[model samples]
Target: MENEEILKKSQKEISVEGTEDFPLVEVPESERKGFWSISVVLLGFTFFTATMWAGGNLGVSFKFWPDLILLITLGNFLLGAYVAVLGYIAYKTGLSTVLLGRYSFGDWGSKWPDFVLGFTQIGWYAWGTATIAILLTKLLNLPQGWNIPLMIVFGFAFSWTAYVGYRGLEWLSRFSVPLMTILIVWSMTIATKDAGGLAGILGIEPTKNMTIAGAITIIFGTFVSGGTQSTNWTRFSKTAFSAIFGSLIAFFIGNGLMIFAGAYGGLVYQEPDIVNVLVKQGLIFWGIVMLFLNIWTTQDNTIYNFSVAGCNFFRTEKRRYFTVGGAAIGTILAILGMYNWLIPWLVLLGTFIPPIGGVIMADFFYKHKMRYPKITKIKFQKFNWAGILGYVAGALIAKYSPGVPPLNGIIGAFVFYVIFDLLFKLFRINNDHVVEGEE
Candidate 1:
């Protein structure tokens, strides 16, 4: 089919599967999916260029095979556990991250999350697209002049799945994730063989010394923002078990492989991206396939993330406009080299983003005792000053306190929010305008 026809059909309308539009409403039990489906999409979400980017960095500091594995394993396990906790909460609440924020941050205050979450995903979308364009030019021997146009072309091309919304993302993830994983494993096998097998790969010494803490930070920092907002997809989980398994397997195994693939290629070929390493090893066709599928799986979800964020932010029924607008903006950013310039900034933002999760988690599990006010019943506040301040408290600690900034932010937010929330209740400082049970 022509790309234009495909794009047109993509935006035509949402079917039932694509109609999970009530961001604040509980997802009906009948609609939730089981383990495998959620896991596949989660795998797609975690497997992307950025994971490989981190892996490549780790390659320079591999230490030894066991130490490296332990580092990534322990690091991702912490992150995965954090995400799984949120996923389980999502399953219980049937609300997106933004919707959940309404409880903690008040109605107007939730926009902080809505905006930050949405903005980060938009950045990811642009970076993923730009990376694709750069790789394509290198693979095709295209001139530099084509980069901007290619970014535009690729941006629209990948966004169709996202334009169709949830069902589109699920369909694409199931089909593409396995293919991408296979190509990655194939590339790893080639790289290991080329590097004189596992012994040689293991024998390769670290060019720069890295601490365990540093390795752990890289693992978490790679996906903290995405993982924090995982409720966007996790709300579809049929059971807490599914959510847990999906997150754990995706983080511990799926993410492990992507990072390993990157580190392996980086150690062997002096390039962190496995696709580029494959190309260096003269596997151009596989490199191109890997690069395309890798970025495709990631970029669609990035757009989907923005779509959810946009819908939540604007409180709109039609999110396709946001989807298209996000794509256009992301593409424009790619054309202007947003990815290259934003790398360090993106990493820093990752630390700040997780504290938002911490506050919500604390509010849900502790203060509410796992029972949120029904969406229809509650007249949420305009501002929950404590929650907002708690997030700021977390961010400040993360920035200055040092030791694993993301963890510091999360813990700080969780502690401060809980403490302040209790004091508010003790002093009878709760919102006077709210009804107890207004549904």
Candidate 2:
């Protein structure tokens, strides 16, 4: 009896310690205010839009246009709306995406999504660093060997900025927003001036593949994944309205404007890099600013989110180490000429990212009813096969769909989740009801 009692007591102690070690994240309630400005959200949107538009412009003008830009744009808008709604929820709840997901995914299950999110962020950071290095090398007539040192330095700079935390990132937002805005406008003006007028470019139909849907798809694909990051940033909002309005304005207007500008430039210049085209058109200053803002804004958020995901995945101390380590690895990859090699990876991400959004949207709006359980209790055994099957189905559909725009990933995921969730509930298998924080 004594030995049994000692074993039981020791087990209890271990359980308590484990529980204490994994304390639930506490997020303070956001201050309710009507005076919040939309500028911050707008700035974020602008950053995303400019990046996508610039990317698409390069792809379309240099290579060939895909057939579904407008369709992809519509898809992007729908996804953006969905993201805005989630952002509103996050602003209202003051929880990050990972925290919010705990309600539906269970505490342990959340790790998978977190891992994927973190991995993607690291990839993006490397891509951004590599892109800037390549652009700089070409602009300055530097040798290819310089890419390695430049990538390492740039990665460290971005990681350090992220280490300073959200304030540093917000400062980046404040600076990049107006700076990029001016550069976009100036570049458009110069491009138009050089092209004679906007009338010719606007009226001239792009080649057969460069349809409106294709342009829109490129825009949407660039930002479709942004929804995953919305909660991280929306936590700073003063109100739900601010989050919604700000995100929409920033994404739609900011993104649309950049695409328009790029299309205009495409009509005028035959160069592959939009910046190079602008430089050749005597808009070198604006081109430089756009390149800088593009690199800074994109990499800053990528590093920040990667740090958050890393911290959540590993020990607190090790999280920082992993983040820096990941950044370093990515930088090395960039230097090794992996950036050029990673287009397929980025495309894969574009395909896979949408399903995640679908799962998240379904869980947030449908399963959780837009309100998280107050207690952290999650039903561990009742692993919703619905979500798993739905995700798989969505992926298959996206993969096998014939000639569908890349945005089909989101569409597939959304449809599969809805159908599977409805079917699961209808069948009423393994249904259990529990209060928050109850395991």
Candidate 3:
């Protein structure tokens, strides 16, 4: 059969017979979603507590006006641009980060990404679970002993939406995004007013010091892991415009807003957590409401990423089972106290995850010329040594020689992947029998 006919039949089989999320194969065009659906879900995913905590860390160190504002804008802009590129790739190929990994990292080599991406997501899930429980106990004046039980309950409960899949995420996002937006704006307004408006806000002084690079790392690193996996949802995009715009809106604007909210609260109330800020502002009821929505939206998305990666790693079609399993692992971590490890985790995420995106971008745009063949049509190597070497090179540079680690990692990975690929090609030409799989 011709490639075109084979492609058509494969797409039909995918649309008609497979799981809705298309964990193992491409997302057929018929399963593609619209801009509104994509935007809100991505936005909800960005509305997370850990991001706010990162912002709070910045808030304590930087001035409210030029310093904090500029850092937030620059960091988020870089993040948005990075994710948007991946989103475009996802839209074009109809594949998630892990599926894309199979092409770049090779069939077996892809498990590295599956493990890294999946582990980071579970870490986030654990943090969220612990945060809500700890905060609720403090804010509602509940017993301290309830933290573990609350963690256990919310951990499993948040995975419910993810277990149901995309529709569940989309439906919950539709309901929660608007309400969260309204609450955020309202809180911002109250914060500004309480601080005596613009003049008072600008007059606020930094109580601590942080370098520009450090601040940017906190901002970018906070979400870089999750941003790398955003292809899970962006692959469902019906148009390139939807994919790009939704990514920018979420990673840049949506995430920046959460950062600003935390920073703004820190500047005014000397508190970074928005829920804590709200409580201080005498919005206790609204604070609880916001806490539940904010954590739930991101927690569900985080677990969904883990499930997708889990499916790819184990070569299974049972995404729902992985979702539940991920939640349980996260719950256990929360019980063991993953909440206090946020900053170091953020640093690690910043230092490592961007290289994966860099390798992916290189694989898609440079190696494949922006087109990927049907997965079934090609046999992959056990490992794409070029990609593996590139990742290692990028990670080392990011960790040891960084002005801005994430940016450094990305550039390093891209350049190194191409160089190594060329070297491998030359080697293969000298000994064709040493090479296997499609070039």
> Which has the greatest TM-score?
3
RMSD of every candidate to native, in Å, equals: 6.0, 6.8, 3.1
Order the numbered candidates by lDDT, best leading. Answer: 3, 1, 2
In order of appearance, the predictions have TM-scores of 0.92, 0.81, 0.94
Output the number of the lDDT-best candidate.
Answer: 3
Ten-residue stretch with the least lDDT total in model 3 = 429-438
The 10-residue segment of model 1 with minimum total lDDT is 12-21
Candidate 1 stretches with Cα past 4 Å from truth are 1-20, 209-211, 273-275, 431-439
> What C-alpha lDDT values do all the predictions have?
0.79, 0.60, 0.89
Residue 262, candidate 2: Cα error in Å is: 2.7
Q: Give the per-residue lDDT of model 3 (tens digit) for 77-178.
A: 999999999999999999999999988888889999999999999999999999999989988999899999999999999999998889899988888888
If ranked by TM-score, best first, what sequence of candidates would result?
A: 3, 1, 2
TM-score of predicted structure 2: 0.81
**Predicted candidate 2 versus true structure: per-residue lDDT over 103-172, tens digit per residue:** 4454556676678877777777777788777777877778988887888888787676566545566667
Candidate 1 clashes: the total is 0
